[model samples]
Target: MAIRVYEEQGIFHLQSKGTSYIMQIVNGYPAHVYWGKQLAFEEQPHSFVDLPEGPLFLLDRLPQEYPQYGTGDFRSPAYQVRLGDGSRITELVYSAYRILKGKPQLEGLPAVYCETENEGETLELELRDAYSGLIVTLSYSVFEDSAAIARSVRIDNQGEQPLQLLRALSASIDMPRSDLDAVYLAGTWNREAHVQRRPLGPGGTTIESRRGASGHLLNPFLALAAPDADEDHGDVFGFSFVYSGNFFISAEVEPFRTTRVGIGINPFDFSWQLAPGEAFQTPEAVLVYSSAGFGEMSRTYHRLYRTRLCRGVHRDRVRPILVNNWEATYFSFTEEKIEDIAKAGAELGIELFVLDDGWFGRREDDHSSLGDWTPNPSKLPGGLTNLAKRVNDLGVQFGLWFEPEMISPDSDLYRSHPDWCLHVEGRRRTEFRWQLILDYSRQDVRDYIYDNLSEIFSTVPISYVKWDMNRNMTEIGSATAGPEQQAEIAHRYMLGLYELLERLTTRFPNILFESCASGGGRFDPGMLYYMPQTWTSDDTDAVERVKIQYGTSFVYPVSAMGAHVSAVPNHQVGRVTSLQMRGDVAMSGNFGYEMDLTRFSDEEKDLAKAQIKRYKEIRSLVQQGDMYRLVSPFAGHEAAWMFVSEDRSEALAYYFKVLAEPNAPQRKLRLKGLDPDKLYKVEESGLVMRGDRLMAIGIGIPAELKDYYSYSVRLKIID
Candidate 1:
């Protein structure tokens, strides 16, 4: 890990392991030169700026790293701001730069940091808009082991007047080559993070979520690779934003065949009030480069997110196998119903019992009792503590659910403070899920919600919490934001939510928190920094989960995929897969159950018991192993995935046939990430196969395994 600035050559070079990021100062401006595999650095490197001939236009002549509009060098701006004088032009020139031993913290943001000076080094460059006195400090931090560079910007108002920021992108990269295809995540509701790869062309192509939450339609991730690149070969560039709010990620190929990548806060309906002496910090973006292909890129991202992004005790700990009551009982469950479920789950070896929504205030459905965190006396007689005690007595951990960010018009909290909800006074409030969003931008509102939840934690023996945000922001206005700063409400609300989460998680360190936004709407690395796992999606069918979990595996570890076994004739897609198939699919992630076990048949119950015992024996392998996507669901009729333990001494593989064919030829399964010389024995059958022959010649799938059938092979190195 190193960061060196050559003043004589006007170059700043950052190296991490085998990757290098080089930038040059051209005419007192930073110009992007190269970012890929490491190259020997000296007075001269392979830089586009070194070209002797170019267009007469200033911007066309130079390859800029982060350009701004109205700065003579005009292509596309990395940042744009409007001053109080009604000027939208921002001409920022490099003012000065400084190097630090380690990363400096971004106040009130969930940013990646260097735990020690030996882990990384930081570089900060100050750019100024002389007219408005706006000082934009671009900060970059490079880590030693992960080869990830974190980038963010701090915009401070040095003038007496206020400045309105029209655009605040986290990081932008200028690549000399434009022949790249973009890889990104795209889906809706039950299907999130479906991979989409398209060729990067001229003009700008953007993927954004203006829904307030990082909507289910698009996840905050993007990758650029040569059109010929595949899973195990070629160069891939990855970019992931660590913010959970509205965001924009764009890849643009210029008329000159140069590509520019940018990511940050969604500029639409976004204008930050940078008052005198105030600074606004954009969320950090992570940059990764992999020459060995998408598989290696995924491993890098998985390692980075698992170790550096997620926090607290659960970061490396084995998560409990929980049974959530959402799919089982939904809104009509009673106290007795919950206790019975818990008792049955304990009998089946379930670790934790999560009492999902509808335990509070008159919340028989989604319409009422959103902000009232107190338990409903009728449904949950004796409140939550008494029920929790009974469940705990049954030898199972207890958990609860809360939607503290929304308020119902019928609830006591909303009636008392109608202004507490986000609304434009004269306009009719738009309701999603029959509730209005709370004005989290207000400190008073955050305090009220946090105190109410904290009171329960202090009294009850709750070991876990499922924090849910049911809907995104609408009627997008905040009463407390006032008229002048109303444009700042969305960003402020995110900050306030972050503060609340930090306080709650810090105060109750023992509680395991799982983030959910109507099921995977708010799934991003930003929330993972606070909560170790997220509800992957609302759809739990084993067949559907193949695609869902498969796409998510690109950036998140298996530890973060909240997979569960729901009822047959599945709730979401209504596809009745075998019980073993569902269990096998769900085991690929943070395993859990979502169906009513009380209704399980004797045979089904025995299968679950055996499955739980098996998981206890092999979850460590699944949770920590390096995953190999053997066959993509999008590519063929079969979906195959495998996990090899870090030491390569153990491996578990799952194969599923989506549809069976008559008299189909036997399929060969070639394993990956194994010691070539080692001999391995299968657990169920004592047959031994050499690692080299298994990968070189391959093995066969069962002939009877057909039509949505699934099979798993657990191998242990025998020699």
Candidate 2:
């Protein structure tokens, strides 16, 4: 009931109760799983030892020692252990030292290798650092068809004073033979942001340099080929595999303090602090597969991800079309302003009203009042519950925004308990956007946030929560912890945040949560595990979004993206675009609007209403469609993409012409993935065309003579 492990047909299944974890292992997969505190051998040798009622484990025996080379004059002895049946196990050894000059290196330890063999596979666990106080136990259990493996490192704080320890898990893999193509997906503002393969080295691998919105440098390590005889050309890769699976990953180390999780590729290394007697753990899953090409790889990854990962949890029957007040009015809105906008939004058939930032505390801007959960009296006058009630009375679901992990130095929360912020006694604390991060790692802090958030939801008839984390960790240090313990802060911070979110979401299942980290910052699979959707980006301009959404759709589904139509000249770009164009672009995703509805002209209002009506008509198809990139955004001056529903009964195509040649005739576009035998009706003219003819000759459309021009075509399959 707690954790289940099964093996069948050379495959392993690991399931955790009430959690999204469903780990599967395939044939020839070299892994093992163990339960209780005993060593077991079934084809592969493994063992698990329980610690003294704590979160730790130990592997007692290891193989004999072998002399190994190290940097400089240092030579470390390497060793390995053989099981009863004579199978070899690899060993890793470490020793602690205070203030060694330059970079210290450990070498000559036995390396565990996993490769395919005819009958099955073999895994060997070796212990190298016998003198070190910490020992890692590798455990596995063989199932009918497969096996499961877990590696746990055990540390003993037996010294008179509690030891502050820095621990890291390093995995060195042989580089892929061919060009390794990869994609990292994060959910931002209802859309996924992707960083894809560019190029790596003389070999064939490449590392993505782009950082996540939360400043996490993703895919920082890349090796072209495996380590060869040439020492100069060797590849060393290491990454702090932060928590994975569904749910947002967060870390808080007191307000204003910073914590970081780092990924180092070459000269492989991982370093995180653990306080005296404090233990930390981070979970990550690695997937490896070979593909003939990038397209094949992409397709395979998407298939596996959607099938095994995504939770198709669709609730709130209406498919809410919301208007977030931040994009509409920013911090300049009042009760009157919200009422006016809500009235207009209701008339336009918008289903949800989200009161963005500045509705709470003295938050006139992002610089203050992050931790204070109280509603801004000056702005709302009658408290959030009353305002929500009034907004609900106008026939729209109410949503509110909260940046729970942030606090301003000027805020009451920080003023009262500065110790709640992360800081070192002698080290300067870090601040971003004039705000500090809270140390959610503490039990009290977690309880405070949970109670506050729960109170807000319980007090108001709120149906949705916009959870925002605006900045990343900087000036990494924690005040309450010693220097060594500070290193453990980052991983612990993320775990604490995860625990809080899990508790909150479980207690309030009906409340929809939208993860927003300055719009796409922390938009990873981890966040999507909790929030069904995320804000795609802070830049809501239609022209820019065409490219952004196109790039995002490469990995994420449209339903998960929060795309909104804002006024133009767009607030971010300052380019005046037609409202219709904006609405059309936004329609490709979970459609909504951010512009102030009351500010729109009567004609614009009518257009908004019509757009909402059209969205409702196509929402189902858009949400569940099989998207196709008919044309690459990077292929030409114009970017084009299309979406066809799973049933292939309906299709939506979007084309944007950023530039046009002087006299180039209309371009003919070849359609893809269509039902060739079926007839189709174009929504634009209600004109019927044979699917075969449409696919064969394609559609011809004139290019835009100016920049930022777009065209959309809808098709319905006719039997």
Candidate 3:
């Protein structure tokens, strides 16, 4: 693959493979720089310069020469400069001579360095732990079309021994003022749950910019106005921006090790580590230029996001509408109870029956009886195979739940193999809700889970698997491994789970899987690779879900979101809402119902039936349409969204005015993604409106009919 860089419209474009891996960077906006051709070391400038004022020391001092391999160390390589204007770009740089002597610290010894520069944007990528015979390569490029966007980096390792290296990518930017707007997306980690945007200064605050065992530094800008910097954890304002526009970072070892890519309002600072013959990559973070402040930025963010990431294939095969027993039954339900719920759901046209937790083992709640894998006799007396047959006989597919990488301290599996859990031999194992994480890193542990899970699939004719991970890593220490091996636990744990899921899906391709972590905890592309759909949130109250789903849809399509109409008062939020309103919200995505249908009143049941029927009719269009965001939930007092299918033949629009002003009257809303040349028929009056007229006049509709009230419009393409 050829690496090429060019400039267009004041933007720098980098391309690989003739035009593949394109990335763009706008002039004056800090850019991403990488060196070391294919499998070479790479680097980027850090966000800020906050080194301690002593002698600036190079990482670990290496002797001038090492005797084992050659005259020069493999870590050191040729350095080249590509300068333009006042930019002295260090295209590539490598450190000199070192060898791994099989010692604990030097087993993976050779360390290489690479650097890049674009105007003020610069970074350095390093490859350490080379002595272990690991081959490391880093890749980078800029887009030819738009320089404001940077191409993603890829780290590939070709080595024999596992190596651990700290890989950091950093960048710096010049902001107009200390009051800069910044946003970042992050997954749920125990202590690193929040992202704080604070001033760095003698006049600013320096909080932990990056967390985890790997240490980092954050220096604030020196302020002229304030003398002392104030700091608070929850003071960050930009959840909507971070959730939708932010980047998700992760590391992969074995084939690839770890990654650290930086994001900054000023510059970039990130890094990673790798084992011999491993690789790692960072998720792409799309940045937009907006002077309209956070609200306008958020609006455009959602709009562009819908046009890009949210579009997907429409399945016309008619997916079964499923009802999960988790929210309804939790861990306390019998076979008769599930059958009753299944029967009720079937009457309402629900096509899938999912039995949740407590079906397995003699467990009653989350605290005990994990890893046993046996069906609880009290709740599932007829055995899972028989239960599956009965549910299948009801004309609905059967599904079950599993938390494979977890064990209860009081469970049989833990008692028999205490070493199976993640813990240090002498250190106390951390417990969350009476549960401990299974040490899937071991082949024995992995095999055990694989065997049990495979058996369940073989024994039962289940059509779905709801994979759940309820807790994050805490007190991360492993018992079976030595101290050097403990740090590898977290990454290995995830890999083990990935391997297990991959096997399960490959073996049972027809069975659909839904990933759930509390609610949206582990909702990332990594998990989506195996499970197409994910439960959006445990909070199903329509009002709260509007924002949650809106934020989620920016990076994910509606088809991938699991939305259900739960009865009010909601279990999480004790507010009672209208059943019609709930259905209206739920219909916009993958539709389902979580509440007990038998508990619904006659009128409510009728409404449920009607809503299900409506969804069935439009599900095709919803699944295969181009989503448009006209008004953002984080912007105005109202929230509005629309979806138009390819060819512009069909469209579904929804607008909700949360709080209406006194005489706001009707608001004129412009519809998007419509073919201006085609004629269309509005469903309500059978009135025909040409696409031009619809686009020109737009739709004049009331902004607020009532609190939580909504209006929907449907359009059909006419030749």
Pitting candidate 1 against candidate 3, the one with the higher TM-score is 1
The parts of candidate 3 lying over 4 Å away from their true place are 1-136, 140-163, 168-318, 659-664, 692-696, 702-705
lDDT of 1 at 667: 86
Instruction: Score each candidate by Cα lDDT.
Output: 0.87, 0.54, 0.53
Q: Between 1 and 3, whose lDDT is larger? A: 1
Candidate 1 structure quality by residue, lDDT tens digits, 40-142: 7666544437644334547655777668877565566788878788878876778788989878888888887667888889888888878888898889888
TM-score, each model? Answer: 0.97, 0.71, 0.69
TM-score for predicted model 1 compared with the true structure: 0.97
Per-residue lDDT of candidate 2, residues 1-719 (tens digit): 12232333222222211111122221111222211112222343222211232233112111111112221111111212222233333223422211111111111111111222221222222223333223332211121111212122233322223333322322322221323222343333433343333322232222222222233233222212222311122221112222321112111111112111112111111234323344323243222222122222233223323332333344323357999888788899999899888888999999999999898889998788888999899998998888988999999999998899888998998989888876666666677799877886677888989998989888899888889887766544556666545654554566678788778887888888887777766655455556767787888977767767776654455666788999877888787777777887898888998888888888988888899998998887676666666665555677666777767888887777766578878786666557988988988878788777777787776566766677778899876
Q: Predicted candidate 2: what Cα RMSD to the true structure?
A: 12.3
Q: Order of all candidates by lDDT, from best down to worst?
A: 1, 2, 3
- Model 1: lDDT equals 0.87
Error of 1 at 506 (Å): 0.5
Reference-based TM-score, model 2: 0.71
